[model samples]
Structure formats: structure tokens, C-alpha cells
Target: MSKYIIIHVFVRIFSNMQENSKDPITQSNEQCSLTMVRRVAAMLDLDSKSFSEGDLLPKGWHFFMLAGETRKSELRSDGFPGLGVPIPDLGLPRLLLGGRTVSYNGDIVIGSVVEKTSFIKSIVEKTTNSGPMAIVTIQHELRPISETSPAIIETQTYILLSASKASNNSEKTLSQPIEAEHQKNIIPDETLIFQYSALGFNSHKIHLDRSYAQNSEGLPDLVVNGGLTTLLLTEYIRTNLGLEITDIKVKHIAPLYCNRPMTLTAKKSETDWKLYVYDNNNDIAVEAEINVK
Candidate 1:
């Protein structure tokens, strides 16, 4: 059958399923664990002693609170836990982090209990030249038990694509180098990738299993977790610029592989700050805009 006909049929089938299925919403509670915060600091080679029970949890560090507890048997074939929320089985096997928007409304203190509410915000099915694909948006609200209002709100978008053959590395192209006011370079190794994945309770094979990444996903090596990339950017701004972030929107343009050096650059404008993560080949892998106080 022709690709066009296949996509058309798939779209009709998905539409029927969409009409019958309802989006899922879930609520949970987690402690802003001081131990976890110290571990994260140690993982980043920062002083673990710097984090304390009463200290405010750093912005973007709330990712661990949203980690999904999906059992092994219930995990998706791709090994994604869906960030603690149940994702509909849309018949699409491949998943990628398209981007995320995060708003910091207040502070979450270490050792405080947090109430988390997560729900699917939107799902759209579309046809692309590669094949039929779906975009899923999930939103999470985290409020400290002591406060009535949410401390942090985050929306993450994922791209779901039909299974396909492994990608060819030779087809990759480099992006033009970006000019920035400040920049830092770091090589994300297997250890860093493993630590971040473990902390977030993420078991995605693309970030953990090398053979699966190369043979199954057609990637050159294990891919870096997109959340980790965003965390690093936030830390850079926090430490180097010493700015307080109110909001951020990030986009993952390309994948950054483990063991490869990636440069993080920031440019300050009159309004907000722009950040970019350039892969080893000088390709822009991630882009973000930050609004600060």
C-alpha cells in the first residue's frame, strides 16, 4: 500500500480512538528530599554540604519530584515511564522530547512535602513525510504542602513517531556556530547520563543502553536526557550570571550524544536571556529563552 493511503487510514483510526478515550489525570505527593538534593549536587561535582534541609530547592531541581513510579512490566516498549503519568498507547513506538516550558512561582524548601498534580493537556495526530506522528503535551503542578498555591508549573511536550529503521550517522549535518556573550563546554559522559536518568527514574534505552541506542534507534551513542540539558543551563545561569529565573521555554532541536563535548552559550538581551547547546559537530542541539527577575 502507498504511504499516503496508510497515513490516511491511520489518521481515521486514531481519530476514532481519540474520541472514545479520555485524557488521564493523576495526583501524588513527594518530599523535597534533602538526600536527593545532595546526591544531585554531588553528581554535578558541586559541594553536597551546600544543600540543607531548610534551603530552598534550586529551580529546575524539581524534576526528581515528578519522576514516574511505573513498574517495569508496565513501562512502554521504549522504556519511558511517561513522567509519572499514564500515556495512551497510540501505536507509535518512538518518542522524543520536543521541548518544555517551566514557570517558577515560589520556592520549594528542602524537606517540605509537595503535592503534585499531572494531566495530559493536549494530543494532536498529524501526517509527516516520514510517517504519521503525534504530539503529546503533559502539564504538572507542584505545590508545597504548606502553601495553598503552586510553587512550580511545568509543561513538557513529546513527539511520538512510528517505528522506523535506525538512522544513518553520515546523514547528520553541522549547524553554524553561534555568537554568545558567555559560553561553557562540557562532555556529558556515560556516568552523568546514568546518574541523571536514575535520579529522574527514567529508563529510556536511548539514554541508557548503548547497543539499543545505536542498533535500535540508529543513534551514534546514548542520548543525553533533555531535562539534564535544561538543568545544566539553569545552573549555568544561576552560578555564572547569578540571576533569578522566573520562567523558561526550551526546545530540543537535535540530539546530543554521550561522550561528546557540548557547549552551552548564553546571550543577554534587554528583555530576556537566550541560551543554546551546541553539539560536538557545532550543531545547535538545544535552544532556550529565560525570563528573569
Candidate 2:
């Protein structure tokens, strides 16, 4: 039987097992400063010269500033906060950011103190062709400390890997290169990864140490920041399409390594849009949907 069918069957069975039993975990409210925003934009090589204090933060930049887990002493060798966040144990040794959606409800200023409340939303165990893995859903809501309403809510999932190493057969699942004509391409180099990692204060070694990623994590090369790709699509939607975004939904299909050129593609879908990012090899790396009004 095919892996997708197996995954679907198990997902249907386990869907109910994962439910709302856990309490919400709230982190100390963190301050959103202009310095942090500009630093992130600069690291992503974005044009932040005109950025000001009270302007609404562009899409995806929130990943850099909000919901920060501040336990430095708990970091694993790989730089992940080993026990910092409440991700379900798949008995897996590896973790990857699968994708996320940011729904904007309001705005925040540079000096605004924002409160972050997060919880473990769900945990779905599936059998992949390579092995068994778990898809852990986590939700975070960010609001100004002074306001009772949330400004943005981010829903993201993480892929937990069971095997200590990535499987070679999994590489065959890649589809033919995307040949879409109307798309913009951006080159991601090692430096970009460095800047982005710093901007997000990410301690994950996968983005910085190519050797560790290749040897320890079994990745082909340095993985670009998934959040960066997400924000890029959001920014493109804002500037090129002139869309006023209300919601974003995304899923990571594959990894795009440093030194690869990523192609961004989007098409209108009713009042919304479907977007994709293709890696240098032409495989769709990320799939996304943007709802605009």
C-alpha cells in the first residue's frame, strides 16, 4: 500500500485520541521594540529603511519577535530548548518546523508590550514511507499587554522524525520541477541563513552549522529559515498583489537548503490566493493559502 493512504488511515483513527486536555501555557509578556523589527528585516535583507515605530509589523516578522521561549540553560546540543516548550514526545530525536499561518486581528507598536499565550493543540501520529512520525500542532496568540483582544494568532505544526537519520527513499518522493512562468526567485545563501538565525535568536544549529546538519541531522545542506519563506510570501502578497491579508495558511512540503534559489508563486482564488515556493531543484518546498478582503 502507498504511504499516503496509510497516513490517511492512521490520521483518521488517531484524530480523536488527540484532543483538548492540556491547559494553556502562557509566557511572560515580551516587549516588541523597533530595534528588534529593523534588525530582523535587515537580516532577511529586506528594505526596512522606511520602517517606523507604530507601523504594523509585516507578515511573518512576528516569528522573530513574539512567543520567545527564554530558557537558555535548557538548550540541547543542537541548540533547541530541550524541554522549554510542551511538544508531545513522539520518541523522536529530530524536529522540523512544518509550516504556520498568522491571522492578524489588530496591530502592535515598537515599544508595545505583547503577551503570548500558547498551548498544545493536537498530536497526530502517522506512518510515513520512511518510518513513523508525529505531527504536533501548536497554537500561539499574541496581543498587546494593555489590550484584552489579540493582535495576531499563529498556528504552526512541527514534524517529529523517528529515525535517527533521514531515509534515502524519502528523497524519491519529490515531484518534477515547477515550470510556472509568473514567479519571483530569491537566492538564499549561507549569510542569509546566518542573519535570519540571528534575527530570530534561533539557537538551532541546523541553520548555522552545515556540518552538523549534514552529519548529525542528516540534511543535504543548510536549511533556510522556514519563517523567512513564510514572510516572503506575505510581503509579496502585500506589495505585488496589493492584497489586504486577513489570514495565512501554509505547510512545508520539503526543505530548501542554503545556496539554492527559491521561486515564489501565487494565484488568486476567489477573494483569497494559493501560493507556493519551489526550490532550486524545481520541487515545491512550501504550499500556502492567503485570505484577503
Candidate 3:
């Protein structure tokens, strides 16, 4: 059969799963709101044109978190290893992705609409085995405009730069100094690292499968994805930076492995805030700057 036919068949099978899932992500006190679900879906369906018309649930805007003027400026800065600057790109490290994560924290029952917002967190320039890399992050929050409790929606993202654009580096050791406004520790272990990798559906050898990563990627065991670290830092800002995060940007500096503990911090500058997911030994796992309303 043609690939399209196979895809159509798979779509039908997944439709049943959605129908069968009664309150897929259980709510604390109330039944899952159908109205809220529709609202989320509608927002996801909106486009740039509708966004220009007015507020349409803030969908595509989140994708811009990975690209912007600030991100471009930082890429051209001197902290990076290469003599020349790199291109500013968007989307996941893996282009064709499985959409964004929808971590259901609470349900906005049917007939209810929740307010949504997003923000750019921070940007960092780092030298990796592949050369200079940028990990941009965006934070999103979904809260009922009215009395909504025990149910909240939140997500942070990490985007990797294309490997081809990385400075041509045959050497694995990063030869650059990472400047930081704040200091943090990186304490990683098997359990925390493994759990995060699993939740993100990341099959990259550098994340799990230690032997392959060490032999092929030439890393210690398995290296952590900067995107996940940026997500964690973006989450920190959502919980602390008030309720008006509209965008976020983050960059990756160094690699973090399992069995290491790291410190996460957030700072503000005017309407923007910076978050750090830093490692004590290797320096920074990822640095993010968030824009708040």
C-alpha cells in the first residue's frame, strides 16, 4: 500500500485511543472540561493571520521562541568559539517532530475557557563537539480566566541548531570560556536523567544507550539534551515569573550527563528574565532569557 494509505489507517487507530481516554490526564477535583479541550484544540488550529486579527489562544507564537532578534544578536557575540557567526534557525533539532508536549496538570471542564500566554526565556552560545550550538526555550501557561483549581497546563521547550552549521571542529574539547551572571551546580544521576529522557521520547544515542553514546558520540556515558534542561529552566520561570510570560529564548553551553546534579536559577531584566540550568563542574547546561508581560 502507499505511504498515505498507511498513514490514513494509523490516524483512524489513534482516533479510537483519544475517544477511549476518559479524562486522559485526571483532574484533582472536577471532571475534565470538554470546553477547555476544545479551546486548546482551537488555539492549536489558529495561524499567523488569525493571530494578527487578535488574541487567538497564542499558538504559533510559541514557535517563535526559538528565533528572534535577541537570539540572532547573541549568536554573533564573541562568547562563541568560532571566529564567524552562525545562522539563527528555529524548530526542533529533529525537524519532523511529534508536535509539542501537552502535560495535563488540571482540567478546564467543558463550557470554560482558560487564558494562555508564552514567553522567550534565554539564549546561550556554547562550543560542542559539533561546534557552536544554541538551545532556545519557550514557556507556556494555561489557566482558567475564572475559578480554576488543581488543573494547570505548562510546557518548556529546547531547540537545537543544525549540526551542519556548527563550526568545523575535528576536536571534541570545547575551547572557549563561558561567562555566567549566576552560578549553579550540576548533580545528575541515573534515575532523574533516565526519567527525563523517557518523558521526552528522545531516542538519540547521546541521551540514553550509554555504550553507543560513548563509542559513537565519544561522550562519557550518555549526554543530556540541552533542550530538556532548557525546558526545566523555563518551567522554573513559569512558576516564579508571575502570570504573564509571552515568549522565551535559551542557548546551550556545555553538556550534562546522568549522575550529576545541577542548579537552576532565574533573573529578571526589564520585561525579560534570564534562567540558568548550570552545572558546577562543566559550567552551563543551558541558559535561557524569558520575556514577560
Candidate 4:
């Protein structure tokens, strides 16, 4: 049978399953631990003593608290813990972080107990040029126990694809160097990748297992976590540019591998800031825009 016919039949079957199913929702509580904050700061080579109890948790730092409490047997075949809520088994094996949007409304203080609610916002299956794939959007809200409103709301988009679609090499041509007002270069090694993955409770083999990344995923090396790249950009804005961000939208354009030097650059405009992360090959890997107060 032709590929289109296969996709059509597959979608029809899944649509029937979806019609009988409901989106999953989950809720949990966690302490905004000062110890956890310090650990994350130390992971980034920052002064752990700089943070203390009652201090407002840094934006984007909530990633650590949003990790799913999935058990060993519940983890996906790729070692991914679902987005706090259960993810439907769509038969697509390879998963990628497509993008995320974060909105900061209130402040979450250290030492405070916060309630997190996560749910599947949407799931759409489609036929792509490459093959059949699905896009899943998961939304999470974190509210301080002492308050009535959520302090942080975030939506993460994940793309699921067939393993046969994995690529071992860059498919696009190298582009010209990107020029920005401020730029920093750093190499992401195994230690950094491992630390970030551990901090976020992300067991995705792409960021942790080299053999799985290479042989299974057809990647050159372990992939860097997209959330880590966003955290770096936000930290740069806060520490280097002295700006307070209110919102951020991030897009992962390409993958950045471990032990490779990636450049972080930011350009300030009248209203917002634009950030770009260039891989070792000088190609844009991540693009983001920050709205500051």
C-alpha cells in the first residue's frame, strides 16, 4: 500500500480511540525547596549562597519542580517521563521538544508549598512530508499554597515521530554567522548534560545515553536539553543584561550535542529581547524572545 493510504487508515483508527478517550489531568504538591534552588545554582557554577529561603524562585527554574513522578515501568520506551500527565501511546517512538511558552504572573517564594496541575491541552495527529507524526501540547500551572492564583503557567509542545525518520547528519547547509549585541560561548560537556537531565528528572536517552542517541536515534552524540538552553538564555538576561523577564517563547530549531561549543547571543530591541543559540557549526539551534517588565 502507498504511504498516504497507510497514514489515512492510521489516523482514522486513532481518531476513533480519541473519540472514546478523555485528556488526562494530574495534580501534585511540592515544596519550593531552598536546597533545590542552591543545587541548581551550583550546577550552573553560580554561588549557591546567593539564594535563601523566602526568596522568589527564579523564572524558568520551576522546571525542576514540574518533573513527572512517573514510575520506572511507566516511562516511555525512550526513557521519557510524560509531562506530569499520562501521554497517549501513539506508536511514534522518537520524541523531540518542539517549543514552549511561559507566562509569569505572580511570585513563588522559596520554602513555600506549591500545587502543580498538569493536563494535556491538545493532541493532533497528522501526515507530514516525512511521515505520520503527532504534536502534543501539555500545560502546567503552579500556584503557591498561600495564594489563590497561579504564579506560573507554562505550555510545552512535543513532536513525536517514527524512529525511521531519525537523521545522523545535518540536513541543512551551514549559514552565515549571526551578529548580535551580546554573545557568549560555552561548551556543553557530558557533566553539564547529565546535571541538567538529572535536575529536571529527564531520563530521555537523547540527553543521557550516548549509545541510544547514536545507534537508536541516529544522532551524532547525546542531545542537549531544550529547557536547559532556555534557562541559560533567561539567566543571561537576568544576570548579564540586568533585565526582569515577564514572559518568554522559545523554539528549538536544531539540536546541540554534548562537548560541542554553542554560542548564546542576545539583541535588545525597544520592547523585547531576542536570543539565539548557535551550534558548533554556526547554525541556529534555538531562537527565543523575552518580554521584560
> Would you estimate the TM-scores of all the predictions?
0.91, 0.83, 0.41, 0.91
lDDT of 3 by residue, 1-293 (tens): 44442211111111232245231222112222433333323332323232222133322222212222223334322112111112244322421111133343443434345454444333344454554444443334556556544234344434344523222122344434445554344465655555554433334555657775565445566566554565455445543443445555555566666766577766667766777665545355566666655
Instruction: Report the lDDT tens digits of candidate 4 across residue range 151-205.
Output: 9999899989887737666545667876877999989899988888898899998
Candidate with better TM-score, 1 vs 3: 1
lDDT of 2 by residue, 1-293 (tens): 45455553234122222253444464667778788888877775567677888787776677765435657786655776532256544577678998887898887777678987776666777776677788777777888988988889887778777648654222455567676545788988988778777776777888888898889878888888787788778878877777778899989988888887889998876767889998776777899988887
Candidate 4 is scored at a TM of 0.91
Rate residue 98 of model 3 by lDDT.
12
Which residue pairs show collisions in model 4?
A: none
lDDT string, candidate 1, 154-263, tens digits: 99989899998556553456667756779999999999999999999999999999999888888888999999999999999998889989999999988988988899
Query: Candidate 4, residue 51: CA error in Å?
Result: 1.3
**Superposition error at 62 for model 2 (Å):** 1.3
Q: Stretches of candidate 3 above 4 Å error? A: 1-186, 239-244
lDDT of 4 at 289: 92
Compare the candidates by lDDT and give the number of the best one: 1
Report the Cα lDDT for candidate 2: 0.74
| Segments in model 1 whose C-alpha atoms lie over 4 Å from true places | 1-22, 170-178
Q: Output the worst ten-in-a-row residue range by lDDT, candidate 1.
A: 9-18
Q: After superposition, how far is residue 167 of candidate 3 from its true place, in Å?
A: 13
